[model samples]
Target: MTGTDTDAAALFASARERLVDAPRERLGDLQEGRRFLGIPRAARIVPRGTAWHLGVLLLTDDAVLATGDIVRSRAEVRRGFAAESQRRRAELAAAAARGGVPEGATVHLGWHPIDLSALDAASRPLALREGDALVRWSAAGGWMPLARYLDERVELLRHPPERA
Candidate 1:
């Protein structure tokens, strides 16, 4: 969405080579300490608690990527956002099942898209327009919506300003 020149096709190809067939050590470095890292096609969200957290969110701005697991395109970004919203709807149901989001509880959900052109090419934290923060990230897995997981905390990380 930002004005930048990134060859999506080349970026995609590079991502595939580095991530789709990466070795474990390379994957570890990316996950543990770098903005860009290689990951395998088998990436997934490992359940850590009663709820779900995409292990890759740590390195990403948002929690969904179009690695071979899902179609990647402007359409996919839109669809992924929809899917993430739906996932939150499901989480809401789950929370309601468990007595619902507390009157004053909070959770943090994160995701990242590898091809976003607005982020800094230098691999550091970048600011999204409306005071939102952006970061580079990649990992093996599908996406997740955690609004219910965040409850009222969603205000803390406001979504990027709506387009004109």
Candidate 2:
């Protein structure tokens, strides 16, 4: 995530403060490929303000305190983008398999560029992955590289969620 130096610090600080007193038991240690996702729910916290949607948790082997709101928003955006990208990929793959080039001999995956300039300090802690969701660290004092976290979480979901 891009942000001014001061803004980034503030965002990091808020996340740390929120987790400071949280129970260690509540803050479980995720196994390799496991994530601690919250329920798929939405809330209208204010009478006039926009409602916020929650995202799935992607627990990691490493300990980090991820908030529900940030995860939900990132997951929703990633899901939308990933769907569009997959659709285009499939269309191009089918065209190629049929032994013909697309109309312009071009295959494109829709890509979006996010504007980080408008993000204030508190939300600037998150990072958007190229093919995955945006994520932020739970701790202000310790930081982990996001790529490793994503790789581990993806492996855990390989078997798919159990059916109720």
Candidate 3:
């Protein structure tokens, strides 16, 4: 693999390891009560045709590497109206019923890698331009370098603040 490819792969691996190592409660917090990673703990969605394109900022390099999926809105709605809490679960189940993917799918069944740069406005906040470093955003932290963001998140996951 080329140097850039190797670096990107390493980045993905390290991030995955850190995420896996985080305490279940912390990971759960990050996932915000979601049942599957494929459902994205956080994401930006855009509607296109019959599907809603789903994306989450998982990692980054030259381009923002994301876990992406396409959910058929019709199918998901057909399953029944989901309250805000159960939306993701309903989408995942509906997607599975439709074979978990459309023909010529760019994203596979699992939350595989996808270039967020290829997406439209949804990618703006996470885009890594030429000669630019990667970053992530949170309401409290705003924009932070990707490496720093990962480290901080993992550290917080390992040591959460005690609740009152």
Candidate 4:
């Protein structure tokens, strides 16, 4: 979701272009996507098979914020992070209680960060998140060390995706 000023304009243009010649029934949904993405006049949207659900793509100064059926603000993301963090901690505890993985390895969870310090250097994950799978961080830089994952994410949030 990081790019230059032109990327933002092009993305918005692509999104807006979808509006013209669209069916009347779909206009409302398209407008909703625009509103959700906080774009002025454009947003590329794909049907999620529901009136309120849509695949949205909107570009900002730094990155394209894409999501399926959800438009959220920074505060919302922070709350979600706190909740997910607590859930993951509990899950880790439960897993440990039931005999966790041995040294040099760890379980992978969609929202949890696995500790790689105890493992060998070669086995370390440069970064771990819902990305690529949910964030696609690997494409940005697989060379990044595991310790820098959080910092990378925080940086990615340089601009928060907003809702109308």
lDDT of each: 0.28, 0.30, 0.40, 0.29
Error of 1 at 129 (Å): 16
- TM-score, model 1 to reference: 0.20
Select the stronger candidate by lDDT from 2 and 3.
Answer: 3
Ranking by lDDT: 3, 2, 4, 1
User: Taking the tens digit of each residue's C-alpha lDDT, what string does model 1 give over 1-164?
Assistant: 43332333233333333333221110110111223366433222222112122223221222223212211111112224367766544443333223322322322223234434544433232223333334222433322222221322222223323670
lDDT of 4: 0.29
- Highest-lDDT candidate: 3
Residue-level lDDT for 36 in candidate 4: 40
Which candidate gets the maximum TM-score versus the true structure? 3
Model 2 segments more than 4 A misplaced: 1-121, 127-135, 139-141, 159-164
Worst 10 residues of 3 by lDDT: 23-32
Better of 1 and 3 by lDDT: 3
65 in model 4: Cα distance from truth in Å? 22
lDDT of 2 by residue, 1-164 (tens): 34353343344344334334332211111112223385432321111111111112322222222333211101112224357766544433443323222232222112112233433334333443342324444545333333443444443333335781
- By summed lDDT, which 10 consecutive residues of candidate 1 come out lowest? 23-32
Candidate 4 on 1-164: residue-level lDDT in tens?
A: 32322332343344334433322111112212235466553222222121111122222222233322222111111224368766544444333223323322222222112222222232223223322112224334444332233334333334335752
